[model samples]
Target: MVLNELGARINSALQALSKEPVIDDKAVDALLREICGALLESDVNVRLVHNLRQNVKKRVNLDELAASGNKRKVIQLAVFDELCSLVDPGVQPWKPRKGKPNVVMFVGLQGSGKTTSCTKLAAYYKRKGLKVGLVCADTFRAGAFDQLKQNAARAHIPYYGSYAEADPVQIAMDGVAQFKGSKFELIIVDTSGRHKQETELFAEMEQIAAAIKPDNTIFVMDGTIGQAADAQARAFKESVDIGSIIITKMDGHAKGGGAISAVAATGSPIEFIGTGEHVHDLDPFSARPFVSKMLGMGDISGLVETVKDMQLEKNEDMMKNLAKGVFTLKDMRDQLQTILKMGPLNKLMGMVPGMSPEMMQGFDADESTRRLRSYMSVFDSMTEAELNSDGKLFDTESRLRRVARGSGVRPVEIQALLHQHQQFGQIVKKMGGPKGMLGKMNPGMMQQMAKNPGAMNPNMLKQMGGMGGIQNMMKQMGGMGGIQNMMKQMMGGGDGPGGPGGMGNMQDMMAQMMNGMGGMGGLGGLGGMGGMGGGRR
Candidate 1:
């Protein structure tokens, strides 16, 4: 089974347990059986699966908990905790310091995506304002330096490599020295891939490590390797001190559980996982959030962090407009643009609560991207006056036709965009009145929520329609039919053949949900009104 299937099976088991009228031993045993079966099918080690079952059984004593009145909660928590422990190595991965050079060395067999991961890590740090540089030390593989060079250039990260340098150790030393001398904060050294039986190559790897001591030696393991990852990880650990691990190619239909469980057994924490082939696909690994997202229980903190990275709160004009409950056509355009920058649409949707992968069926990410770009074209064709206006100026057929001709889009599409803008405008208007949610919030409180979306204040939640309001919002997004309706509206009432709408509706629905929950404070950073108005841009 793949990771998604594994998560779904485990979730189904937990839901079954939740539905049981009586939490009996039989039900608990059935739950354990289901979870263990899923894990084993996903290539998780038999021994680890047994241990997880035993641990959950020991943790949840049904008879003892019968008096607690929360037996279901206890049992579910035990399962969640054990699953987290199954993947966690209990070791903290090394972090790079800001002022000094932190060397990260990559090691794995050939075809493990080491070179790409190096560039991904560099890009990740580069986005965080760190001076990161890449070093291509893989002289063993043909065209290794070229691959690293092309990747580095695409990511715009500085790199050092040699076409003539045949000695991998020498290249590693020289590259590290050059980047360190240049005062680069994070220097990643990519070494040649080697197998366990290759004694000579292992010796060469040891020589390179001696030349330039890496602050963190990451074992880049292929997630598709299944249970064999355990032995490979142990072999690499025995050869050199592997400080951390990065499991690559996890986005596919690979049986990744075995690799993850195997690596965790080696006591080297997984620092990151390559989710896709894209240069920005490396996601920092956190055991809890990983399991939560896998179980379709959205990672709110992770979502907030992603939004924070975009620095949407820095858009002063957008924030001010939102405070006054104003969402103009230009604001909608900017939000769409920000969504385009926020990476894959499916990935974003996965971060939201109640948005399970099953609910995202038929959502085409690439098509949604094209549709968003098309909307941008329509916005570009509009005059500044129209962009700043409340979208009423486009009511004239001539004006609509002029924009449609200019943008090369159907008039219906432009009308769709205008209608979407009107919906947002109405929501913003409600938030502006004296009795509105935004009107009730103080400026300082709004700024605080904007800065840290995850840390929602209790008073803010109460003022913004409280938990009850959030529950109602969730109901609107809980079903496929609800999501389909929202998509239809955003896609201009299915104007295109077979309805071109996709996850693009998620942005609008999320914005509307935030508004319905009293104001745009909840998930506003992602909706687009800067930090606390619409949603993430």
Candidate 2:
């Protein structure tokens, strides 16, 4: 099983037990067996999988537990905790200070995506408004500098590399000194990789480390290597101070579990995981959110970070208009643009609480993007007044005919787009008002939002799938806790005036929840605003 399949398998096992009235030893053993099988199949270290199974079983302790114990919750929590421990080495990753230059060195095998990972890391920090520069010291590879130069140019990031230099150590020293002298805050040095572990490779790696003295030396392991990742990571670690790890090529790698477990064995924390070929596909590794995503529980923090990274908080006018449930053709176009900026549709879907990767397989990214473009074209064909209106002008036959002819699309397609707009507007309108349902939602995020003016208004919540999305989220949070109580649980089960992080009150919690929602660049998927109810009338 792959990572997605592994999570689905565990979720299925737990879901089966969730439906049972009585939790017996036989059922518990069966569930553990299924989970263990999934983990083993995913190429997790066999010993680690065994330890996890035993730990979960020991913690459950069905024989000693009283009748008062909620057996299901106890088992679920145990599984959750053990799963978190699977990849967590219980260590802190390297943190870069704001005012100082943090030189990070990248190392891995020849085909382990070390160069691309370096560029991706640079892009990650670049998106955070940091002064980042890339240094290509992999002179051993034929086109290493060219590749890094091209990637750096495409991302508009400043880079330092020497095409004439054959010595990686000299180039690394020069690059680091140059970037540091320029006051670059995050400078990444890319090192060469050999076909196999050799003395020359280790010597050069150690020389580069000594030359630049990087604050973090990340071992970029290829996730497709299965159990071999353990040996490979250990070889690199024996040569240098491997401060962190970044597992690459996990998008569809069945053996990704092995690489992750292998890193855990080396006692190095995983800083990130590359999920796709794009620079933005690099995700910061967080244990709980990763496990939650694996179990179909969603990664709320990842979603929020994506939103904040996009700087969506600057759109105050958009929030105000959305709160009024006032959506026009122009607003739809803006939403479509935001969706495009947020990245792939399937990726966005995987971030939602109840959305599974399997469920999102049906969404063809290219087809959907073309469809969004067609809708934008239709809007372009409309008059300025019509575009700004609530699409009521399209109700007339002549108006429809004119737009269809102007946009070179069928009349029915135009009607379908209009109908979708109407549905969206209606949903938004029904979400909240001065005396409506907005008062009853997750208050923690809402509290966070209250501090940031225009980050999330009541109207914006309506724009985020209205009540349907919230209900779906509540259902995924075990259905019985309700929004307020679930908010409490999400806030680390705290009480009194403030919850975790000094949340002022229930209103503050709601604000925080709202802020999180607003920061979700993939809000369209989370709110169920996708599909638009079909393509044609």
Maximum-lDDT candidate: 1
lDDT of 2 by residue, 138-187 (tens): 98889889999999998888999987888999999999999899999999
Candidate 1: stretches off by over 4 Å:
440-445, 456-507, 510-520, 524-537
Candidate 1: C-alpha RMSD to true structure equals 4.6
Q: What is the lDDT of residue 182 in candidate 1?
A: 94
In Å, residue 162's CA in model 2 sits off its true spot by 1.5
Which digits, one per residue and each the tens of the lDDT, describe model 1 over residues 1-537? 138778888888999998999999999999999999999889998889999999999999877887898898889889988998887878888999999999999999889999999999999999988999999988889999999999999999999999987898888899999998999999999998998889898898898888899998999988888888778888888888999999888888776887887555678888898888888788888887778778866565566667667666566556666667787777777677766777876677666555545655556667777877877888899899998888889778999999989988888767666666676677677666566566666666666666666556677778767866544444543433454456444434354532455323544664553332222445532333221111211
- Angstrom error at residue 176, model 2: 1.5
Error of 2 at 363 (Å): 3.3
Score each candidate by Cα lDDT.
Answer: 0.76, 0.69
TM-score of 2: 0.81
Model 2 stretches with alpha carbons more than 4 Å out = 381-383, 396-409, 431-537
